[model samples]
Target: MERDKLVYKLKEFQALEAYQVDLFQSQIKSLEDPHIKHAFERFTVREQEHEVFIKDQLYSFNGGTGIVGPAFKFAGMVTGKALDLLSLKDRLKLGIAVEQKAVQMYHEFIEMTRHDPQLKELNKYLSYFMIDEELHQFWFKEHLARIENIEAQPH
Candidate 1:
């Protein structure tokens, strides 16, 4: 891929990671469960790391950090607030959907990078990010199932 094109793609991913960080951080503040809040805190940190990694990759190509737009950030915040009003199971379901989309995005990017010799490192990073997203998805699924199971139990 051309340097400019690769940089543009990286910027897009960086913006996404930034949005996720904001969303998770906002949700963490409203979570009453200590375990859930802690998980979100960790997710926020991981997403921040992903953003920084993408920013550094952009810098390597002499591309400036493409700052996420204010409107996008605002949307994430609003979404997080709306999600907080949902039941825990509903929140987890949404989280699973979000993480699944992220995983798919990373997987597609990784496949695109497969034929480009210059993108090997980026491909590796994308794989790592994808795995993290998968883990997040799994966590949400597991918790959602647990919630459903408990609700189904005889009182």
Candidate 2:
């Protein structure tokens, strides 16, 4: 992928991660279920860590390259508002959906770079992201299943 296009998409995605970090943080306080709250706390920290890595990647570029760090930071700050608007169950479902999408996007990026030897390092980094996304999806699904079970029980 071209650096400009790659950086553009990456920064955009990175911002989403930042949004997720915030959302997860809020969930820590809002979630009543101990299991779900614990998971949210775990994911929140992971999201924050990913934000730092994403920031590093975005910062590696200069404006002359048509992709800047500050631009990405601003863009990331704009995402995840919809999560706040969602109900608790819907929020977990949406998170699972988004994480699935993230995995797919990383897969596509990896495939796109398969023919380019220059991007091997990038592919490696993205593979780690793909793994993390999948794990996040699993955790979200687990939380949903647990919540659904709880909701199904008699009061």
Candidate 3:
């Protein structure tokens, strides 16, 4: 029963991630700037991949919808659109914050599954993904700075 609960939680997280990915993709679709659109598209794809990975792991346990996916979709739409207008530095800062939250969630899930062997293994993969996301945030920030420097040139 407890394992079932954990599976449900994982499924809920996956669904939320999926909803956000959809929302991000939609927001990116409206952007005119290629570079910004590309960044958003990349984020959307990465979120979608993470969602699928989580879903596959949780599906074996027959987990059902744990949270309201529609609500997540709506919230993500609003947030993603607002973020799309921010400067690259702000976007990267926001990404870092989001990744930190994800890392915390993964850590909490890891602790919650202390008794579940399979979930513990999944948690290790999730931790690696969280690290990857953190690296992405750093790279975005660095790239933003480089862009700013180039734009500062006299023309």
Top-scoring candidate (lDDT): 1
Error of 1 at 1 (Å): 0.8
Expressed as tens digits, the lDDT of each residue in 1-155 for candidate 2 is 67776677677767767777876786576677797788888888887877787677766743425543444343223234554566778878877877876787778878887777877776788788789889999988887898899999999
Return whichever of 1 and 2 wins on TM-score. Answer: 1
Cα RMSD of all models vs. native, in order, equals: 3.0, 4.0, 4.2
Q: Which lDDT value does model 3 have at 152?
A: 96
> What lDDT would candidate 3 get against the real structure?
0.66
TM-score of each: 0.87, 0.75, 0.66
The CA lDDT at 107 in model 3 is: 67
Give one digit per residue, the lDDT tens place, for model 3 in 73-106: 2223336457667765565566556655666666
Model 3, TM vs. native: 0.66
Clashing pairs in 2: 15-76
- How many pairs of residues in model 2 come into backbone collision? 1
